[model samples]
Target: MIEKELPLFPLNLVAYPGEELNLHIFEPRYRQLITECVNNNTTFGVPSYVLSKIEYGTEVRIVKLEKTYDDGRMDVRTVGMGIFKVLDFVSPWPGKLYAGGTVEMIKADHDGDVVLQEELFKLANDLFEWLGMEGLVKFDQKMLTYAIAHKIGLSKEQEYELLKTTSEKKRQEFLINYLKLTIPIVKQMEQAKDRIRQNGHFKHLDALDF
Candidate 1:
């Protein structure tokens, strides 16, 4: 297994590859961590602190440093590079105040069968319409799963499962199954909402012949 040492930033949410995330850094240890990354043009690992553990995560790169407060807080923009599995965790890495660890990078397959992708896109389009979102889905094929994973209704655990998935076809199948189960419910709820909207409207009644 290929492994490397990285700075660890554990958060309560999952970060998927190709998704841009903005963060507000307030803690002292994290502040130091970000400072080092900015100064050295380095990368960090964002392990999701969910399922009561920190094992899987995405490797992240600092895209931009938006702001730095007078007291050391920072606003930074980051993008997920890829996924990684934590192998060893160190509370304080020798001299640093932040955590560090050895992580094995997870290889990802972003391309799936073309037919399967088209099917997924069709369902995704219908889902967007039901939720009142406009525009056709035209994301890069390689990054499709990560791009839309957040927009659909997924719990933290579900998102983590998607992150753990390494095969494109498997991920596509996973999303397709979720959409298949969810679309009908969303459609029914929308219909119910429309019926509720007609509560105050008047209707013409047909006259019965005597």
Candidate 2:
């Protein structure tokens, strides 16, 4: 297990690799954390904040610092580097107002089976059309999972499961199953709405030949 010390930023959302997340740094502790990371050109870990505890998170690099307020607050942009598991948590590191911990990096399968990739792409494309989203998205191993994750209506728990998954093949299988289950339900809801719309409508009758 590889271990490294990293600053921790806890949030209510899951950050996937290759995805962009915007943050507003107003809290004094977090402001200090961000300042240190920016000045030293270091990266931080964002753990999934759930039920008042940190469970899973990804390492992110600050790509842009949009603004800095008069009171030391900041607006910044970060992109997910990859996922990591916290090995140890430190509430207050020495000489700092923030928290940090040691984490182990998770390996991801970059070149999963090509056949599985094509199958998942088809399912994602079909689901997108069902929801009337314009334009199809391109899929590859690195981004295929994250790109369609939220779009496929997976709950936070499900998304976390995907995050914890280390292999691309397993992630693709999970996505395929989620899509297959959800698409039918969505179609049924549309049919129900159609039925309600046709209720109480007047119908024209043609004369019958005697």
Candidate 3:
């Protein structure tokens, strides 16, 4: 039932909660939008861009305004706050330079299946090892999905699908299946690379002592 008017920034990427997204602001409309947000201490929304339309988005608040260029462009550091679904869209809100929309907040569940989380963690670690990644980022029930979203190699559409899912358990299951399918394929690729690297190597010969 959470509804509010949020400034919408449509992009081809998905922002997950507890994740930091750095953005470059150049367009005049968005520059105005960012400036207003900074002045009013308000947050904005980045609706998921899919096939020339926006349906879902994450509400984000600027953590810091990193830089302001001479041409009025800027770089900002922002963090995602929550998932939202756009209920209505308005381009150029009245006299404003930016687009906005009424969005309904999608509640995320915290109580996911513990056993499933543990299993997924193991699979993720294994996949990381296969990919030659050192060390692991600790994951908890609260931010598990966001922490692993990028690590699982999900496509933009798949990540958006993950963002749309409201239930924690359902998201966990979805990621687990994705990892299950991807891990073996990555493993095969790694093995093939190893074989190619050994292509012209000499083998030790055993003496025939018959």
Global lDDT of each model? 0.91, 0.84, 0.89
- On lDDT, the candidate that comes out on top is 1
Stretches of candidate 3 off by over 4 Å are: 136-143, 205-210
Q: By TM-score, how accurate is candidate 1?
A: 0.92
- Which sequence of candidate numbers ranks them by lDDT, best first? 1, 3, 2
TM-score winner between candidates 2 and 3 = 3
Badly placed stretches (over 4 Å) of model 1 are 136-143, 205-210
| Model 2 per-residue lDDT tens digits across residues 48-129 | 8754678679999999999999988899999999888988888887778888989898877655667877888888877777
Q: Which of the two, 1 or 2, has more lDDT?
A: 1
- Cα lDDT tens digits for candidate 3, 1-210: 799999888998999988899999999999999999999999999998964678999999999999999999999999999999999999988788899989999998757888888888888888888998838655554457777887668999899899989888898899999989999999999999998998899978799999
Of 1 and 2, the candidate ahead on TM-score is 1
- What pairs collide in candidate 1? none
Report the lDDT of model 3 for residue 189: 100
Candidate 1: minimum summed lDDT over ten consecutive residues — where? Answer: 134-143
lDDT of 1 by residue, 1-210 (tens): 679999999999999998999999999999999999999999999999989898999999999999999988899999999899999989887799999999999999887878878888788888989988757555444457778788788889999999999998898899989999999999999999998998889968799999
Instruction: Compute the lDDT of residue 103 as modeled in candidate 2.
Output: 89
